[model samples]
Target: MTAEVQSVDIASPIDVISEPVILTYFETLNAGDFQATADLFAESGVLRPPFDEELVGREAIAQYLAAEAKGMKFQPLMATYGVLETGDTEFTITGKVQTALFGVNVAWNFVLNPDSQILSVQIKLLAGLEELLNLKPGQDKKKE
Candidate 1:
């Protein structure tokens, strides 16, 4: 299966993502420090990944990322922040995730606690149904 290259307007200036913890999370993740990334979250924080079971707590998030996100890098393009109805702070970020296998657009919605720790991060893939269906296992590797 072949992946399509979509045109993204990267010429526009990226909006500032003001949360220090969010910034640190991405930095640690890109640096392959999964434990440090997980530490930025609350003790009972939740990580809801696309098409996977929700992982709750720092330990679970750390383990899951260590196994799944080894060579992944996140390039954040833009962000928006607001308050949820439940009084929690919500921050949404749009970015492209680059892996050893492929690159995909994604959105991460974060709910933060009063202490500014991440309470939950819900990840969603920004792809159409056809694009998603076209993805195949080991597609990025050459057949020996």
Candidate 2:
């Protein structure tokens, strides 16, 4: 009789991610502390959007925030809805944002460094973003 070894898969996706840092992100964003939110990322961090060009560096991120704040008349009342672990160092954060216009669900894909600093964040929409923002596909609110 011969003994055989079996391999098991460990790359399973987790349903909920309890990261305090992620919670802080929403808190800072809701507080209108754009600079503090940018500081949560690493020095060379990048913010990628679904339709717009990628923004890199703290300064660029700050400029983007400033432009958006000026253009948009409302801010969302956001709360973390759930999280999904996608990879060893990556996860997707899902949230519900309630605005005056409408309520929308959004997803944020985050890649973190060893030090817990965010390396990149890709923003995605699950529902109601377009109609609520009153924009078309590929249209930028920053231009308003």
Candidate 3:
């Protein structure tokens, strides 16, 4: 007998994301199209992931995501928009990221240039130190 695979449908948070470029970033990243995700950024865009050195430029961003973000899904829940003193468009999205082994809440702060291309994305984990320390490498958790 063959085992049937089941697919879970997670609601798209595109409506909550007001910025077009930011919407595309989540869409492409969730689709596991690393290169496409990277292409949303400007030529000198930066990705600042938690606990790591910033990945600078599209090539580095694509390569890093390809290596680390496979099987990861981002579910954005809320967004706050603003403008920096430098006049760049900025926004922060709070969401949960589901990985094969576990899920964690995260906030992504995006900075966009005048042309709507990504200037930088800074990701911060919302988990407490105790919560983060409790996660086991191979433990599977139900998607919340």
Candidate 4:
């Protein structure tokens, strides 16, 4: 009689996801703290879009943050857009993240890792971001 080995996969996509993951750079990113944003990545993390250049490791993220930080005017407006888990190690976040880049709003789709670190961030710079600096997606800051 021969013995065979079997493989098992008990972890579903949700197993690796850290839902309600902490993102502590919202206000800092708006404040042009690129270094701060860069610090949020894991030491070996990667940030890339579907058709964009891949940013790998901490230094790369720091460089990218430096450029973005240089273009800041004031605090950015951001919120929790949506969360989707594709696999055990893959997660997606679609949020209304705004900045003064091109004086427009930036709706970002931030693909992240299990540790709440950034893997990718795609921004849809809105047409009139300057006009809505005080708004946070569903809420209007002007009403205050």
In order of appearance, the predictions have TM-scores of: 0.81, 0.62, 0.85, 0.49
The regions of model 2 sitting more than 4 angstroms off are: 1-17, 69-88, 128-144
Off by more than 4 A, model 4: 1-23, 48-52, 71-102, 127-144
Report clash pairs, candidate 4. Answer: 30-76, 105-129
* Best candidate (score: lDDT): 3
Which lDDT tens digits does candidate 1 get at residues 46-140? 99999889999999999999999898988888777777666678877888887776678899988888798999999999998898788776664
Q: On residues 1-144, what C-alpha lDDT tens digit does candidate 3 reach at each position?
A: 112322223356777786889889999999999999999999999999998899999999999999999999998888877766676887888889988878889999888888999999999999899999998765546446
| lDDT score, candidate 3, position 77 | 81
Error of 1 at 107 (Å): 0.2
How accurate locally, in lDDT, is each candidate?
0.82, 0.60, 0.86, 0.49
Best by TM-score, which number? 3
lDDT of 2 by residue, 26-129 (tens): 66666777787788889999998667899998888878866663322222223232222432256566554444434445677777666778788888767565
Give the C-alpha miss distance for residue 46 in model 4, angstroms.
3.5
Which stretches of candidate 1 lie above 4 Å from their native place? Answer: 1-15, 136-144
Off by over 4 Å in 3: 1-12, 137-144
Question: RMSD per prediction, one decimal?
Answer: 7.9, 10.7, 10.8, 11.4
- Cα error, candidate 3, residue 59 (Å): 0.3
Candidate 4 lDDT by residue in tens digits, 29-65? 5567767777776777665533358788878877876
